[model samples]
Target: MNLHHNLTKSRLRAAYLVALLTLAYTLSFIDRQILSLLVEPIKHDLSLSDTEISVLQGLAFAVFMGIGGLPIGRLIDRSRRMSIITAGVAFWSVMTAACGLVKGYTGLLLCRMGVGLGESTLTPAAYSVISDSVSPRRLGLAIGVYSMGVYIGAGLALIIGGAVIARLPVDTMILPLLGEMRPWQVVFVAVGLPGLVVALLMMTVREPMRRHDESFAVKIPLSQVFHYLREHRFAFTSLILCQSFAAMSSYTLNAWAPSFFIRSYGWSAAQTGHAYGITIVVSGMLGVVSGGFLGDHLVAKGFVGGRMSLMGAAMICAIPFAASAPLMANPHAALLMLGVITFLITLAIGTGPTALQELLPNRMRGTVNAMAVLTVNLIGLGLGPTIVALLTDYVFADPLKLRDALAWAVPMMMLVAAIFAGLSLKPYARSRSQRLLTQQPVENA
Candidate 1:
């Protein structure tokens, strides 16, 4: 009875830990993504162009995330992941709230950069911790559950921000020392300050003992990681680039879908937010969990490439629906298409990286994931919004023609993503086998 009681307690603790990590991920995304819903207001207030706005939405936030991820990842590998995550959550939460305090485009941009640097600490640490905490058989689902926070936080940011902005008068409020501020600025403060509470909650989760810790006694250089990648260049490159394009599509939609509806269908931000938020929560949440289960199921069934195979298939299959969602004549039809597209595209977001993470030994996992994230953020977050903006601003020179830009970009990116993911299969399988063979001696020791 005591043994059974202990097991139950252990299981519950594991579940609680995962839930906390999921909450952290959700908050991080809310901070990162709220800017999407505020595009027009921010532009008007700051007197910015489409190109300039794109920089704020994409490059300003992403560059630091990409650059800082490497070192943070290294630190995560070397230090206690839980402490890094706790401090990071607090720091990013403060920076997110500071977004409202900024007066100029440069100030907001600097705040965003801070948010990026702080947020960069999360995934490497969270993924590492979750991997360390969960059993191997359940790792993919653990990751998938964690990934759900992305869409949930993003969805809530839109729903909540749009709802708040729509309700508030189009006027500034005088708040003592803060002086006057727009409704949108208020939303940032509201969304960002709550993360501090979460940082406190993280302290409850004990750091799990590191797995495969033998090699970790000494620090591994970045060059060694680069060398490992060089050896399995085809698999890792194909995996990174493939996911990067899919992320490009994902971020593009996140950044612009609301604007598209407002421009094309005359929908209010609140209206779009309410509807899109539901779709994101229902479809996006289901898709993320489904990806994890599917990846694990495939691997269990003895398919090499585990998660990537199913993920690639979905990407290929999703191309038409994803591209068409933006071009629908009826707003309702467009939304329906968006549901399918979102479901399909997001199916791999959690699983793909988790699959890759499983391929690595624990010591190098953080750095490897950091590199992967750098590619995802630099290529995906860094360029997704900008590409669409470039087309609307220069290629078409009409905001109304945004649908055309989406139609062109989404399909192209997804198709290329599918091809590369498929190409990664044999290489990934071979690499996994080799890694397993290499690890046998250590495990036996």
Candidate 2:
């Protein structure tokens, strides 16, 4: 009876931990994505072009986030995970608020870089911690719950930004000490300050016990991590490449979809925000959670490559929606198509990280996940928006032709994603087989 009580208490604590992490993750996305909704006002106030906005939206943030993840990933493995997360939450929040103070492109770019660097500490550590906290059987659902923050944060950002923009002045405002500020600047400050409270809340989470092979030497070097990746090169590489390509379309639409609505269909930002925001939250929540359950269901039914198969199938299904969504003549139809596209793209969010956790032992989880972050961010976030902007700016020579760019870019990305997912199946299955044959020990790979 005492054992049962203790187990129940432990389970409750784990649930609380996952909840807080999800909240923090949600706040991070709010800070990262709020800028997207404010792009038009910011561009007008700052006199920036789509190409410049694309750099701010993509390259500035992605480079730092991807590069910074490597060192932070190492720290997550060898250092105190909770403290790392707390410090990161505090730092990014401050940087995000600082974005409000910046008057020029350079200053804004620097603050974004700081935001990216601080945010890099989150998922690799969170994935490692969550993996330690739950049984393998329940991991898919647990991670899915945490991953919901992506959509939740983004949706809330749109909703909140829209409301704020509706209420506040888009033009410059002169305040006492702050002097002059635009509505977009105010939005940055508002969204950023809440993360400080989250930082404090993070202190309450008890560090999860690390689950690892007892025989494995502690603090394995980065070299060993690389060696292991090389040993399972096909599986890891294919997984990374497939997800990266899929991410290209995801990030592209995420950054520009509101602008697309405003430009192509003549919708107001507020209308786009409310409609698009609701769709993102509802569809994203359903898709990610469903993917987790579906992956777990398939595995339980003895499919070794269930996760990869689901991801591939999802991308293939998404190709038509990705191609046609932006081209819709009616605003309502475009938004409905976007909802479907979002659902299909986000279905892999939880499944992909869960896949990485399964592929590696605990000691290697952070580093390998960080490596995956580097590739994904570099390819997806770094280039997705830029590619679309370039196509509009150069190929079409018209900013209003953003829909044409999306129609061309997104379908191609989904196709490559599907192909890579297919290539990954056999190799991933073989890697899993080898690991199980070695009694699930990965230290000597």
Candidate 3:
């Protein structure tokens, strides 16, 4: 009875931790994504171009996020994850609020860079902590639940930012010390303030014990990490390629979708915000929950190949919706299609994270995650919007042709993503089989 009680208590604590961590994750994304919905207003007030906006949305964040993730991940592996996460949440919260105070591009860029630096600590530490707290059997669902933070945060940002921007006399707000601020600046302030509260909450969560034997010296130098990649070259390569392609399309659409609706269909920021925000919450919620459930179901059925299966199906399903996304003449129709695509594409996200965690031993989780994030952010988030913006500028020198150029570039990327996702299946399946074989109990002859 005592053992049962203890086990029940532990499970409840784990569930609580997952819920709190997921909420923190959601806040991180809200701070990151609010800028996307505010892009048009910022551009007009600051007299910026599409290319410049792309840099703000992509380069500024991605550079810091890429550079900061590894060290943060390393620290998380060695220290208490709760402390690391709490510090990060507080740092980014302040930086996000500072973003509202910036008077020019350079100032805003510096603040955004700070946001990236703080956000970089999140995933590596959060994943490691969750892995320790949850059982392998329930990891997919746990990760899926946690993953909802991304979409939910995005949804809230769009809805909240839209509502705030719509109501405020943002163009003429004169501060006692800072002079008149623009609507976008007001939007940033409104969106950023909540994170400070979240940061305080993050500090109160108890840290989980690190799983695995402490004396198991599995720390590979960076050189050996690369060498291990070479050993599992096919699996690593496939994972990177698949994730990169998928992320390229994902980030591009995320950054540009509101702008696209505004430019192509004459929708106001508020209208597009309400449309995309609701879709993200509804469809995105369904996709994440279903993806996790599906992955868990497949795993239970003795198909250790659940990650590949879910990813491949998601990529394939996403392609048609992506291809049709720009073709819809009505903003409503376009948003509906986009909602479907978001749901399908996002299904693969937590699958890769969970698979990598399962494939690698406990100690190297942070390093592997860092490497993955480095590649994904540098190649995907860093380049996706820039590529689309560049292509839109060069290919559509005529203003009339810009929408078509975006449509062409986005779908082609999705198709390529589908191909890469399909290619990853064989290597993922093989890796899983090998891992299972190695973990099997030895016979006592």
Superposed model 3: Cα runs more than 4 Å off: 176-179, 214-220, 398-402, 438-445
Clashing residue pairs in candidate 2 (N, C-alpha, C atoms within 3 angstroms)? none
Clashes (backbone N, CA, C under 3 Å), per candidate, total 0, 0, 0
In model 1, the Cα lDDT at residue 79 comes to: 92
Q: What's the TM-score of each model vs. the native? A: 0.96, 0.97, 0.94
- Residue 407's lDDT within candidate 2 is 95
**By TM-score, highest first, what's the ranking?**
2, 1, 3
* 1-445 per-residue lDDT for model 3 (tens digits): 9978877877887898889888888888888888889887788878877778888888878899879998877776667779888889888888888899989989999999998889888888878888888877888888889888888988888888888888988457887776778778877777777887877887777887666535534455667666767777787777777777777777888788877887888888888788888888777778777877888889889887777778877887787777777878887888888888888877876566777776765566777787788788777788888887777666675434546756777777767766776777788778877767765332211
The sequence of per-residue lDDT tens digits that candidate 1 reaches over residues 106-221 is 88989999999999999988888887777777888989999999899889888988898888889898877778888878988989999999999999888877777776578878
Clashing pairs in 3: none
Give the per-residue lDDT of model 2 (tens digit) for 104-159: 99999999999999999998989998888876778888899998998999899898
- Deviation in Å, model 2, residue 251 alpha carbon: 1.0
lDDT (Cα atoms) of all candidates against the true structure: 0.86, 0.87, 0.79
Candidate 2 Cα deviation (angstroms), residue 424: 0.3
> What is the lDDT for 229 in model 3?
71
RMSD of each: 2.0, 2.5, 3.0
